[model samples]
Structures are given as structure tokens and as C-alpha cells.
Target: MKLSHLLPALIWLMAGSLCAAPPHSDVRIASPWPAQNTILAMLGYGENIVGTSMVAKKIPLFRQSLPRIDSVPVVSVNSGHELNPEQIISLGTQILFVPSSMTVPQQDLLRQAGVRVLAFDANSLQALTSRVQKTADALGPDAQDKAQRYQHYFDRNVALVKERLKGLPQDQRITLYHSMGNPLTTTGRPSLNQDWMDLAGAKNVAENWFAGKQNRRGEVALEQVVAANPAVIVAMNKRDADAIQTTSQWAQVDAVVHHRVYVNPKGMFWWCRETSEEALQFLWLAKTLYPDRFADVDMRQETRRFYQDFFAITLSDAQISDVLNPPQ
Candidate 1:
């Protein structure tokens, strides 16, 4: 069977603007967004990616499912912080996907060379929906339908989590801390970090600092974190979560004492970020924050379902563990 047959989200995201496309074999692309690469693969355009980014090239799950991922040249470094516009043009990349905040020094150069650079803001849930569409649009009609289906699945799961939490007391929202990249670095402003935390019915402590004036991924002092006294804490890496759990300074923190510090699940990319996996992130976070409220939600089963449904990949129990725990 064709790899396309194995990936059905393609049909779901490819439904709009059937203004047609080149032969499926001809749609070459490059992008600094790691999540965008995973989504393109889901739409059955994996082979067309000739230029990729450093982070996308390193995702373990992405490599396992799409071995060809290893063959794509890394044309952009960290969302174009260091991009090779000449290399992208040389690779014949038709579309380049990036965040609106892109800072590459040669963006004008890419346009001059006839590369269509598409930028979108994916800082919030509302914007994420549009981002997926914008990405799919470049892939042409087939990806548009897949984006719609993914959106429906995402929204439905959000509603399910919301409905399930309705029985909990209004005052039960957990006071939480979410660490990004490192143990103390966390969400600031204009990030989906707040969106999922809010969806999971938790109060993110960082949102209150500097009146929400921090960068999307900013650092907070250990003293500041202690003062927040969050009931739960989540870190982007297992080592950080372990630090919160075992370090002396963090020992007095409520989450550490209560054993609530957790390693965020990461698949194609950290689920806590803009990846399609945020659908599962909200469910997992809600369950972690209030196990009683989500007693019936089996995260293992949910993880298996998400990978199978959206990415068309079947995972072993060990693979599921890797996604949830992620290696240090």
C-alpha cells in the first residue's frame, strides 16, 4: 500500500479549495515549524519535503514513522533563527512555512527567488485552527479536508473534557505551574500554554507575574516559583520534573510535596506546544490535575488512539511510554 493510504488524515484535511494541485509528487516544501512537517506527513506529502528545520529533523517519533524525514536537508535552523534561503531555493521548495515572528535575515531574498513564504500566528487555540488551514492551503485541497477533520476532533475532545469537568465544584480549579524548555522557564503571554491550562481548568501561576508581560517562554526565579505555591507543576523535560520532585529548594513546593510534578508528553513535538497533539495534552493535563474528575479517561488508550487516528501510526506500549515520558 502507498504511504498515502496509510495516512487518512490527508483526506480529512484536503477538502477545500480544490483549485487543484500539481502531481502529488511535485509539491516540494520547506518549513521551520516542526509541527508543520508532521502535519504535512499526515496529509501524505512527506516525500515532497526537500527542505526541513533542525528541530523537526530531530523528533524521535517523526523519524520512526517517516524514515524519509532523515533524508530531508535541514534548511532552517530553529524556526529560521538561522535559515539558508539559498539552500531552500536550491532544493526547489515551493512553500516555506514559518511563524509570523520569523527573524531570518533573508526573507526578502526567498520571495525574490519565487518561494512562497507563509507565516501565521499559532499562539492561541483560535489561531491554531487558522494556522492548520493556512498550512494545508499550501499543500492544496487534499490537506484542507484533513485540517477540518483534525479541528473537529480537537474541538470535540475539548468539549468532552469540558463536559466531564462540569460536575466538579467551580472552586476546584488547580493552581498550576508549567515549565517550558527548563525547570523554571515557563509560559508568559500570547501562548497556548494559558489556553490548555485554562481548558484543563487550572490556574497558571505565571499568568499573574509581571501582569502577564513575559515572553512566551520566559524564566522565573526559583524564589518566585516558590511564592506562587502551585498545587501542581509540569516541566517540558523529565529531568526538570525530577528536579522539582527531588531538589531541596523545590521540596517545599506544594507540587513536589504532593508528588504532582509531571513530565509533559511529547510525540512529534512537545504536546504542550502548538503540535496537533495539544488535543491529547489538554486531556492528559486535566486528568493529572484532577484524577478524580478524570477517573474514567485512560490516557494510555487515548494516546494510542490519537497516534493511530491522526498520524496513522500504531505504537507499542513502550512507544507510548516514550511519548508520555520522553527521554532525558
Candidate 2:
């Protein structure tokens, strides 16, 4: 589907007079991360955002105000055909910011087309720091302060999660089933989602069976999932929960019987957007699954604060509840 035509504020952003020393005037950034977009926009580089691949654009700030570009320069399945080199050169993009797993051939193509591509991933504590530094260097000395601030806040979030997870008893820890998509797939042992689950003090049920660096997710038979009987089944969509709830086959699962299913909040961009908001999502999910262990944390207030501080947007209590309480 073409998202470019649905965008409402592209003209307004482009029409605004350019700044004399716009830090990103000469640069064009394409990121799938929501947090990256928030940071770039906050620093007055929103106008410089020529394109976006952010999956969180459905959320309030992005849906209402962000520009949508004609095409994304990357493909998930094949890196070679991710972007057309001729088209990229025509766009006049000086640089492309991508995730670490972006293929070497894609990198070479960008270079050959006179475009610089930098890959980064902030899935772990250490990687987050490196990503900040690299982003700072790319943006020049002017972005140093912002980069440091990003580092400081992200560090605190990670530290807080680590501190909380440290004291949980292994046996008492919740068993999680992270529903990935249409087929109801889940994160396997080696995926980033498993890392987040571990960080949240939960044991991933699919870890032992599937093993791969990329998320080992695929269709999970309903009967099999029920047989495993996880303590918490985190379905990304409320609709999925309803579908499972209605299925006669799921009656055997402990999670279904005990009503222990939860859906992650929308607009928080935990799934697709890579903003610092993600750190907040990790915090929120951990607190949600183990409320007693994290009773002091207020995920709703925290999420609202993140939106206000980073995206310059505010969310209402009702909206927050909608994301937290999803139909079931």
C-alpha cells in the first residue's frame, strides 16, 4: 500500500523556512526506529527527514504530523533488491542509516551510488551506547549534547530493568509466549525478543525448540501452544486473543483458562519503532507481566511521559487504557 498520499503534513514541514545551520540539511535519513525519528524531529531536523520506514507512523504524532515518502530504500527478504541504486541516486540521499543486519551487498550498492550507509542496532545495553556515538559522529559535533542525553536516559532505563530482574526467583518467573504475527508465531531462543523477555524476568517458552539469530518465528499450532501452558501469553493484537479465546481447541491451555493474556500497547512503538520509547515498552511489559514484582512502577504515566518528552505529543488516560486493556 502507498502511504505517501495518506500523509497530511508533508507540505507544511517542507514549506517551513529552512534553518541557517540545519544540522541535517545535507543529510537524508531513513530509519525503521521510532525513537530515532523522535530524536531527529526534536532536534529540528524533522524537515530534513526526506523519508521514513517507521512502523509506528500509525500512532498519534506520526499519523497526524509526519511526512510520508514515496518508497523505502530497503527490503526485508532480499538486501540486493532492497533499494534500486539508480532510484537512490536520483533521490539525492547523501547517507542511509540502517540496522546492523543490513547485507554487505546493499552497503556496497549504496557506496557505488555515492551514498554512505551506516548500520546500527540498540537491542542490548552496550549496543545502545555504540549506536548513540555513531549517530553523534554522523550528525557532527552539534549533535553531541543530544547524543549524550540519549545515552544517559537509555542507560537509566536499562539499569532500572536489570535491577528489577535481578531479584526475581527463577521458579516464580513467568513463562511467556510472545505472539508475533498473523500465524501466531513466537520469538525463539536466539532472537532479540528473547533477550527482552529475559530482561523482563520472564522465561520464553519457545526458546528451547527454535534456534536462530533472526527471530525464529512461524505458525504455532494452537493445540501445541495450549499444551505448553505458559503463565502469560502476550498476543500483540487483541483480535488474536479473541480468536484464541473463542477457539475450542485452546480450552486446555492454562493461560486461556486463567485469563493470563495481555497485549502490548499501541503507539508505544515497541514492535516496529526504535525510539527510546522502546526502552519504556520493555519496562512496561516487564511491569505488566509481573505486577507484584514491579508494583511501584506506573506504566501508563511512564508511557505518557515518554511521548511528551520525546515525541512532543501527549496521550490521554483513555488512550493509554485502550493500548493496555485491548478488548480482552
Which of the numbered candidates is closest to the native, going by highest lDDT? Answer: 1
List residue ranges in candidate 2 displaced over 4 A. 1-26, 31-44, 54-60, 65-81, 103-114, 121-129, 212-215, 271-275, 322-328
What is the Å distance of residue 59 in model 2 from its true position? 4.5
Local accuracy of candidate 2 as per-residue lDDT tens digits, 1-328 = 3434422233233223232334455666655455566556644455555545545454554554454423333322244525444444444455666666654344554554445677786555356557656776777665666667666776787788788778678898888787866426776765566767877888888877665434466666766777678878877777887776677877667777888777766663443224544566667777877777688888788767766765566777876676566543
TM-score of each: 0.87, 0.77
Instruction: For residues 219-307, write the lDDT of model 1, one tens digit per residue.
Output: 77999999989999888898888778878998898998888888899998888887778788999998888888889889999999888
Model 1 misplaced regions, further than 4 Å: 1-21, 77-82, 104-109, 167-170, 212-216
| Candidate 1, position 6, lDDT | 31
